[model samples]
Target: MSDWKTLFHKDQFRFIDHTNSIEPVTALDAFAVDDALALSVEKGASPTTMRIWTHDQTVVLGIPDARLPFIKEGVSWLNQQGYQAVVRNSGGLAVVLDKGVMNITLLFADGNKIGIHEGYQMMVGFIQELFADYTDQIKAFEVKGSYCPGDYDLSIDGKKFAGISQRRVKNGVAVQIYLSIEADNQARAKLIESFYKLGLQGEKSKFAYPTVEPNTMEALATLLNKPLTIDFVKNRIREKLTDLTKELQQNDLTAIEKEMYQKRKQQMIVRNKKALGDLFHE
Candidate 1:
């Protein structure tokens, strides 16, 4: 585990908590925000940032997912199920997002300085700190049957509760994680399972999708056997980061960042349009 103290040895840390905001910030917008903040940090105009955001009933898909055999049918199924699906600009497969799930993006100044696993270890260490009181058994290993399965999947015992992925823009890196704070994790997993079933339809493909098992994934509330809400987890993040930094202040985007965000967001929209084909306009 990389030491948070060593990785983030700054005097000040910028905080942006969008947990309770009523603004129309989509998951697409969140990626743009990270990109803009990352570039600002790379230019030495902004401090390393900790951003918390959540989207209501959205399924964030990866690039490969859009290439599934019958992705259009899968996407239509998602729409019929009342979930808005969008492809993320980051590396990962499909992940569920809702009020019950909390996303944390730790933006640092440079990507080249850190190895990929080191970036993941930073988040793993931070999460271990967050749940220090509850348990120390949180493990990081690939959970094979879990959605977005990766080596950095944070688990307790055998069930996965969170997964980490990293994205780099220019010299900046955003280490992002989606923590399943509450609700039925199996329900979320089942959605993805069905998506692959419809999309793949037993057809042969170059890429192999996971044979999702809902039991392999769980929420913090279920895994920890405690009432863990998104608000509660947000507080834990703030408390832990506050203890490590000399100063932690909430900061919004600057005018330049906002402009950059608009451009990135448009790019995302265009990418989605291209990737989803007819599904994009719908």
Candidate 2:
């Protein structure tokens, strides 16, 4: 209800689903792509865009996370667990990425009209609408002891299943959410807990990292008692867009966006190198 109508009542909604990409789309690439789309919207080259993406077996770290005292050991441990590590181009601590997690980005050109909390609230409303049929009990609040905890973490009955973060480029804003569709949320939390344990080593850091508890998180399938799949959620997102907007169409990146994507992708690479040193540089 907090200005969500202004955020979502667009004449055109461009839908892009990258959930089935055959190529290895790392979390870094996903960030770059979102920035590209956001800039495209800002420049009036694209309409409001909704993108769905997924990555397999990756751990996305925040900039603060890269500065952890024992980061190399933590990254090595993630590698041993068959998870690739990369720092994201935004805020928040470490978060898990796997096949069962679906990431959604809603990009809109707001031209400084939207505040940061407004963007987060818009995503909260959109997600509640997305799953309104199942239950109207979704709540947005900081789920303490959960990975990437924030004031806008989305949860059901006190257990978090999703987290929202926002990034802005020029006049455009990208509101991103990661929904644990159907997988081992506790196992994912355990991995993050170990990562933090190795990275922090009980040091008193400037930033207060989360003390992840496996019980603080739950997958949507478990939370809703419904067999939810990424594919199913992807379709539902498309359907919801169609129902909410004047027009909804599956879209590919324009030439301008593609060019911007390449530049932003390079920027992401450089950022990762600076934050991660030789571990990210190829």
What's the CA RMSD for each of the models? 1.3, 1.3
Candidate 1's clash total is 0
Instruction: Estimate, for each residue in 1-282, the C-alpha lDDT of model 2 and write its tens digit.
Output: 366856557777789988997522688888999999999999888988889999999998999999999999999899999998988876788999999999999899874987888888888999999999999999999999899999999999999999988889999999989999997999999999999999999899998889999999999999999999999999899888888888786877878888889899999899998998866733
Model 1 whole-model lDDT (C-alpha atoms): 0.88
Pairs that clash in candidate 1: none
Residue 234, model 2: lDDT of: 90
TM-score of 2: 0.97
Give the TM-scores of the predictions, in the order they appear: 0.97, 0.97
Error of 2 at 110 (Å): 1.5
Q: What tens-digit string does per-residue lDDT give for candidate 1 at 12-56? A: 888889888764378888888888888888888888888999998
In order, how many clashes per candidate?
Answer: 0, 0
